[model samples]
Target: MEMLIVVAIIAILIAIAIPTFASSLNKARIATDEANIRAGYADVMVNVLLDDNYDAENGNASTAGQTKYYLQKDGSVATTDTNAYKTQGKNDSATTEIAGQKVGAWAKDKKVTYQYDNTKNQAVISFE
Candidate 1:
């Protein structure tokens, strides 16, 4: 009888722990995604500053007078299209590539979107 009670308590503890662990993991992923978006925006801004005629509307492509930016798995920048960004989260349906580089993985329920505001000369990253 005593052994049965102990087993039941252990089972209850396991059930409680599993969901908490899952939640924490999800939070971590969200934080990472936010950081990636911020970093990518910053890199684009730097490129704009360096070029005298950086046109946000046409700067992301590889054509003449346009700059090429490559997104990697960790959300870092690369000069070439070697390691494009791949989705790492629940939303595998969303496109991981933005402009020319890999953005971070977005969650299915909380989708992430990016756009270049030509009038403001800024990159906007938002979650919806």
Candidate 2:
């Protein structure tokens, strides 16, 4: 009889722990997505600075560069690609890229809701 009771208790514990563990894992995924986005944005900023320097030396009218991880234009980051970035400066259209992969809903809300703050300049990312 005691053995049966022990098994039942273990079963209950497993049931209770599974959902919590799953939820925590989901949260971790969201956190990782946020961090990736922020890193991409930082890369974009750096690319912009580099492009500006290149333009200064080459005397080229075009001052922009785009890749899978960064974008730059006219000495600063470009925020005009809706497919890439959305909602710039709070009132602008969603036209930008985070890490060159196009911003998603989680990145658009500024990570204030179900989303995560993916902006490198405005958000913070930590690892487990």
In order, the Cα lDDT scores of the candidates are 0.56, 0.41
What local lDDT score does residue 60 receive in model 2, on the 0 to 100 scale? 33
Report the backbone clash tally of model 1: 3
Best by TM-score: 1
lDDT of 1 by residue, 1-128 (tens): 99999999999999999999987876666556656666766776665556655545654422212444554556665556455554344534345554445554455444333444545556555444
The lowest-lDDT stretch of 10 consecutive residues in candidate 1 is: 59-68
Residue 104's C-alpha lDDT in candidate 1? 48
Colliding pairs, model 1? 71-101, 71-102, 85-102
lDDT of 2 at 127: 16
In candidate 2, which residue ranges exceed 4 Å CA deviation? 53-62, 65-128
Residue 104 Cα positional deviation in candidate 2, in Å, after optimal superposition:
4.6
lDDT of 2 by residue, 48-72 (tens): 4455433534333233332223122
Residue ranges of candidate 1 with Cα displaced over 4 Å: 55-70, 78-82, 90-105, 108-115, 126-128
